[model samples]
Target: MAPAGLLDAFWGYERALMANDLVALDGFFAPGPQTLRADAGGILVGHDAISAFRRGRGGAPARTIGDVHVRRITDDTAVVIAQTLPSTGGRGQQTQVWCRTTDGSWVIEAAHVSQPAAAIAAAVWRVVGSPLVAGAASGPLVGQTVAVKDLFAVAGFATGAGVPAFLAARAPAGDNATVVAELLAAGASVQGIAQTDEFAYSIAGRNAHYGTPPNGAVPGAIPGGSSSGPASAVALGQASIGLGTDTGGSIRVPASYQGLWGLRTTHGAVSRAGMLPLAPSFDTVGWLTRDAATLELAASVSVDAAAQRSLEPSFVVDPSLVALATPEVQAAFASAVAGLSVTSVDLGDPDELVEAFRVTQAAEAWMSDGAWVDAHPGALGSDIAARFAVAKGITEGQALAGASAFDGARAHLDRVLGDRILLLPSASSAAPSTTAEGAELEAIRGSTLRLTCIAGITGRPALSVPLMTVPVETTAAAPVGLCLVGPRYSDLALIALGAALMAPLVE
Candidate 1:
């Protein structure tokens, strides 16, 4: 039998967990760097890390203890195994090593949790299969699986675009999008159609209708979108390639936030036929992967070599652009840049270009989806609804002016970039907390747009390399990508450079 007070302490800890009693929970765990709590997400080491996670997690799911088994190893140490029956109808097991400290109170030193596997995560995927669509017999991407963003036309399924009403109104596609066909031909099986921001307009990943997808990197952070689903699927190891589109920062933002390699091909480099468009002027096809090699392989089959232009290995840095990121991101960028050969240059006013890009994007978005949105009232989430409202009000004159400004900025950046690569932070900061809202969220979005809009305006190939990390509350460290903007058609070359840069770190 267990010690006199051991079961009491265990039950007390359970109460604390279900009630989300942070203080009491903290007291239950031994205070040390060696304390551990692990789950399907990842491991949390140290009392501080565990505490931080609990504080941000809102609360644990409602569950009842089903079976309890205890083994007393010594007078002061014991092991406990408990079966948990979640209110949601899942069986899970929790294992913990408990020890009686000098104070004669039992505390958890280490823990491991296992939950039943989910057939499909609704938020991450709208539809899934063992293999939604089979790939070719053999190719470079053989055995690879793809998460096709809902914006892409996957044959036999309607592109939902993260809107229930829109999806209900549309008919199943007769053919796959050009990019989807290319991937299928390259031997990458389609895993399923993943969720995207409503109409692929917003970069923030929260889908108000279906709920937000989990961030694989940061436990309680937003999974950057509109490519949120694909990124999450890849991060969670559900797929090998995340076929997505980046109009503003859909691919890169999520790539950075989730520590994946994302490549936004040069504008028009990959066919947009059969794919949904948020902003035609800015929309470009891209891929997200956990590693650089997978990204390169996926791009090889789609990008045309003849169209690609070779450039020197030289790199450039725009101080003004780097300043747009958070201090932690800025510091990380500086450290990374310090080791690379780069030249400093001025990229001009970011806000001007950002505003111009927004205006143009809004106008295009209104033109593309306004009719549908108008037909169906209250179909969009508050955030996107508000954006569309602004888009609805933009005068044609204002759109033309914004387009003129964008054209000039695009030309200027193209000339400035020449054949050299521009290095910068992929996002303004690490992924924002899930609770962040209102002005704070907008500020982060604005800062990120300032960085992402540069590539969009220029229509250049920008690669988000998962090379840096920033400290976050939910985990020990959250990733922030080091973005590389190259000349048009430099998609393959950019991937090569990123792989080489990451080689040393992986070693």
Candidate 2:
């Protein structure tokens, strides 16, 4: 008979697989060349190959597993066999050789998946809609593969905003979003529409109807959102460029979580026309890419170059802001910033800044989504529903005052930094565990927003440079981003700075 621990591990693995939690799925596999998984498709010879398949596979269909039988080979190894029935159709067999790693976690050393042959979409895309074209493609982004967030209009395609009801209610987009048109004109091809948080409200990446997109850089970690889908595609190499919208920290947080180069363009830097509004006051279009060159290329095609300003590389460090990170993250941030000459500066209480951001963002979100919520009633996820409830409670007087305060804070930041850049943690910590819920989950979100809200409120450009790693419970080291917030219209400059800081990784 298999050991009790082995049975438990199998049960956990099954749950993760059903949820399409790609990060957790990756953790189940042992690291090294000898570790392998074979399926109807082909043999995956090592950890990297298996991981690539998981990232690009769209996701395994929801399935139920039964008749699990485990055979104990030794103290450190066991064999598990189970039958899987996918919700769509057909049956399959899964065989796994489970081994205990040095850190006492169970991982599959070898496995085989056998299922009835069928066609399936790539796992990274939520909807593989028909592509749109803008005349002949010819520009800086030529030959690049692009994936857009479902919130963006793609002409002929439906915009779901990660909610099924939303898609059902909305008509097909009449025209491509300005960013999409620009990318197409520049020679990039559209791949598909990616999933997003319901109405682009949450940074947790979980969607009520479509499901969460997996974090490609750190398996078993949450892919930060409301831009989850775009970040995942870019990190997985499924798409060369990912066009996403950042309202609050959507683009920067996911970029940090997934270890891709992500930018939150300056407010008004890129036109928001043809995109669904989350909070029109703060919404801005941005993107993610694997390297600095691509990041520059995409930015060139999207951003209004005339708005850019040449700034000195002098850096300002905010200790209070940096202290929000976990010790591991703090150390990583310190190391990444060590080579540059740094000047310490204070921006006052982050809590106050976050609260100001909260009020204004909530007010604007309600303005945009309240009608839909009232019409559909129970259409939203519980967490999002609760957030909407909070927004509903905000008095008009409070909202106006909050908006005024937010503007004041922006002016304050602009004056403090002047032509220099502000350095802070991109996220308070590494991505929160998917299992985290209730108050625990709220706390993680709250803490992260405190750090990210700074750039959001200021409407300044911020880049999440994946130059550091912090230890999470399951993985030895997971990525953390160090943010550089620059003055308005400094979007391209920030990307160039991030590229310089991550030169070793890119080159």
Candidate 3:
């Protein structure tokens, strides 16, 4: 016997199809500014193709749905293998993978309405999905699974950093880092290393060697940052959490784009004994997770013993800067702020602060990559080369000037942050479109470093939380993240504030 809601379910879906009777089938699809779309049948995206798929050879039935076995693929999505009741054929099989939406809907985010695609999709999806058992582990994190960025050293596995030469040059590490050792002792699991950009330098996650992690929520968008692997791993539900480092915006950028939560604590708050150094002053270990509370768990285990002093995320939002946010992002931010008594303030003259950040980052990055840059001038990407060149001409006078200016920024920071925290944008806007580095890239980098530089300059702790998002035609775009920064040794305080902020976000 069919369930009581059986007819209701069928009718609801059927009514949506019938509603398009007079309205063209294409009308149901989100509007396209006329970019051609090709269906599985290979026709251009207009009303014709959409209607054909719906009409089914001569008005037989809207696309058929048969009983395909449903299998959970990731924390956010599930894949079901079944047959499509075809209009022409006797029977045709398909796989429907449903991903969870913020509003608690599991929609067909990706449908491999065929067998071959489903098989390949299922295998690779699983790698990016759940039930990840650590392939490399002596103990704890071994069976308890954790996803590591390709940037970290793993004994047998090549550290590609998404570069072929890097992979070839690497005589793999003989043993795990002491951090990995600790995780093992704690009975945690170690998932395989995830992907990162070539050289682990770029803010965008495009890697010429290993492919970038697909946007977990968006179809044709970038997955921001160097620590991008762990963000995708957690977002896709493959691993409970992911580990990555932040120098500029490595960890937070990806976390912001993926709508996951991340925290870049005080510079010296975490140990860096074995991690690769990008900029010793700014390079800090951080974790990515689904929520603020889970983030606290990682912080407790990871922060340097002496650095784990009093901490709480003081509410801070610059309404002026917050207003410039994208409409959707603004809505997201506003929704997060509602019902919470956050102390808002304007951080005037963030200019000198941001400049100090540039001077310091470029100088240190030059030290980190300058040697390779000299031998392989042509090998360096133009954007990175441009940044390196800025470092080459920094006179001692300029460095001193930068230091003095940074001191001023610190004074301003001290006056403003007296027992209080300020909320700010993680990035100025939402995720940029699927385009290469351009005006959008320039704007994003400027805004990200500007806000991020505050913590860097003060050597304080900061956390980025994905409290809001804007819906695109087919999926959601990563929105402005609410960040909390506190004075040095206040890593735990920032975590507390993050915990405090969560209620207002979804309430």
lDDT string, candidate 2, 1-507, tens digits: 776477788888888887778889888888876777876433566786577667645677788886788888988899999998888788888999998877777889999988865432333476653343433456777778888898888888889888788788788888898888888888888878887888999888887676667678765567889988888878877788889988888988898888888888988989888888978778988988888789889889878788788778989998988887778888988888888899998887989898889999999889998888888888999999999989989999999899899889988877888878988888888887666666876887787888888788888888988888887644556788889988889888888888778787657
Q: Quote model 2's TM-score.
A: 0.82
TM-score for each candidate, following the candidate numbering: 0.95, 0.82, 0.72
> Model 2 residue 435 lDDT?
60
The number of the candidate with the highest lDDT is: 1
How would you encode candidate 3's per-residue C-alpha lDDT over 336-432 as one tens digit per residue?
6776668767666555567877776666776776776676665555665666678777777877787677777777777777766767667666655
Q: Which ranking of candidates, highest TM-score first? A: 1, 2, 3
Candidate 2 Cα lDDT to native: 0.82
* Candidate 2 local Cα displacement, residue 471, angstroms: 1.3
lDDT of 1 by residue, 170-272 (tens): 9999999999999999899999999998999888898989888889998767899999999999999999999999999999999999999999999999999
Better candidate by lDDT, 2 or 3: 2
Residue-pair clash count for candidate 3: 19
Query: Which is the better candidate, 1 or 2, if ranked by lDDT?
Result: 1
Report every candidate's CA lDDT: 0.92, 0.82, 0.62
Which TM-score value belongs to model 3?
0.72
Query: Which ten contiguous residues of candidate 3 have the minimum total lDDT?
Result: 115-124
